[model samples]
Target: MSSSQPSPSKSAAQGPGSPIADAAPLSLSAREPHVPADRLVAEMVPPPRFDSVRFDTYIPDPKQPSQPEAVRVLSAFAAGLGSAPSAGKRRWFGKKAPAKATGPRGVYLDGGYGVGKTHLLASLWHATPAEPQLKAFGTFVELTNLVGALGFQQTVATLSGHRLLCIDEFELDDPGDTVLVSSLLSRLVESGVALAATSNTLPGKLGEGRFAAADFLREIQGLSAHFRPLRIDGEDYRHRGLPEAPPPYTDEQVTRAAHATAGASLDAFPELLDHLAKVHPSRYGALTDDLRAVCLTGVAPVPDQSTALRLVVLADRLYDREVPVLASGVPFDRLFSDEMLNGGYRKKYFRAISRLTALARDAKGLVAQ
Candidate 1:
């Protein structure tokens, strides 16, 4: 695919100087003839443990009643992309002029948590027609991690070849990330890279009460103008069938039983972590919504620094979400070795430990019942 922007060096795509270089490759595609569509979708846009979710299966919350409009907008956007004029199109008159584009350049799907923003974005991505190399899909956290690994200009240059970029969990919790994303969006749109993004916060309201008022307002306004805004009003699908009471035993108890029993397994917790890693890819933000509980058994001391760091991130996500966690084989204090605690992510590890301990105590009380 030809682009007006210069191509980035091979090193840039591979994250030459960043810690995230070791992460899984960020490129995504679904063009293999033999690959099943569902599996391809899972690899391209890993939903929160909902690999099979599609627009057809998305049940709109009746109280909100906004699915029809949302679906219409997305369908039109997908249809428009195929018919939209190329970036180089021009008209001949007394003097040549660029052809005017007919449809919205991009779209912003905004809604509260669990309202199917990711569902809509993934559906649109699956519907768009593009070669495997011409598309990219990931979460906002993953985007930032990429930018950090590859400089902003290099990252944008690499992404410029793509016709579509679908991002989930768009947020503005960090001022630096807010600025970076705003600039990136401007450049990508100018280069004719269409964007489809999902966010819990509306553009105008992004970073409200969190960052400096004027700075956030200016940034959000600039970004919002580039995309047509569509709201998806609905109840959180995640809460649809949740139990009224907590589980009888905490995740820790389960882990302990598995450890004490002659033959037991805590494979589910690791599998859950794997799924979370695929969804976020490079960062742990926005994972709280996807995770509710965990069980860890045969917990030996963590020797790898990177593995320990990941566990810290996982613990933070569970703690922030107030999700119950269970561990056996080794006490919580023994999970991390002294060297691991003293590493670069010491503060985060400390926070995780404190939160996990408290959560475990709460679980013990419930088990006593």
Candidate 2:
């Protein structure tokens, strides 16, 4: 939800006199959210959309046996956490004892987008017996950003107290992330912090096409050792039986709808991109605070890889918040260029397109004929 204050005239116009004026639309571009370090750590729980999701609420596709099996395995994994030795569990000499991990201590859900991996990951987080503070959940980007904000040792001190750490959309995009996350997780595991993750790529294959992964095989392999890869095979559930996304609306239509809809945000796509660059990706969630819908005009293809990646993070935050997106100009499928779409980050781009399309569909009801 954007915190951008509405213009005085716009606010006055939307004042209590008229029903349409009772609620003012927001502008995403106008907000520059600054999140503090402690807030970031406190907000690591599952996004609101998944706040209440548990294993029982997950509806697995009958066609995909792997789907149901993922649920079963994850359920058992969460249960096992209750019995695992605590971080301070020690040997007779007052030294720490190695985790009695019968097998891989963590589980990795590897699947394409919309395969309910996130749902399962959140479910596991909720099912864990520890208090909310003892279990942490966040995206891979947020995890890395936490390290950036809190420093490696401080982040470990913070999260090492947790009994479980659930990472969604886990990825290793570069050698730096490869080394950072590998070292971080290794320390956490030694502290007896249980780990679980979900991603399109398997643990071993992470950063494959995106970078010279072979150069970091040792680090990558060390990271992989922390998790038991659980294969989840299924179609993207977002488009499984849904109709095609509605076509773009006219700018006038978008603007008009933004005025009529309470808490909706209106912005030109290009301006929004520029704004996102100024705000850290870690603050994207705060940037969308209280937003009902996102309305964009003059939507066009992203200019370059950096901009596209930033938009992907924004798209993810919006999707996580379940904020509808109403837009004019280009459709989401055309947001990325062919070269970018076919490049190493294709999976990320595709996921963004899928998520944005779903949000677009969610916003169709906000438009008027």
CA lDDT scores, all candidates in order: 0.55, 0.83
Q: Model 1, which residues run further than 4 Å from truth?
A: 1-44, 47-51, 84-98, 202-218, 248-252, 256-369
Backbone clashes, each candidate: 2, 5
Residue 358 lDDT (model 2): 97
Would you give me the overall lDDT of model 2?
0.83
Compose the digit string of candidate 2's lDDT tens values, residues 122-163: 999999988998999999899999999999999988988789
Candidate 1 per-residue lDDT, tens place, 1-369, comes to 111222443544644333222222211111011322233233334443334556677677777667878887787787667654334232212334346475567787756545777777877876677665566777666577677666888777777656788876555445777678878877776667788876554323333532222333455557555577676765545445643323234456664443332211234434444444444334343333322344454455665665665676566445444555555545666667776666544544554565566455444432323
Clashing pairs in 1: 251-326, 252-326
Highest TM-score: give the candidate number.
2
CA shift of 168, model 1, Å:
1.4
Q: Quick one: RMSD of model 1?
A: 13.9
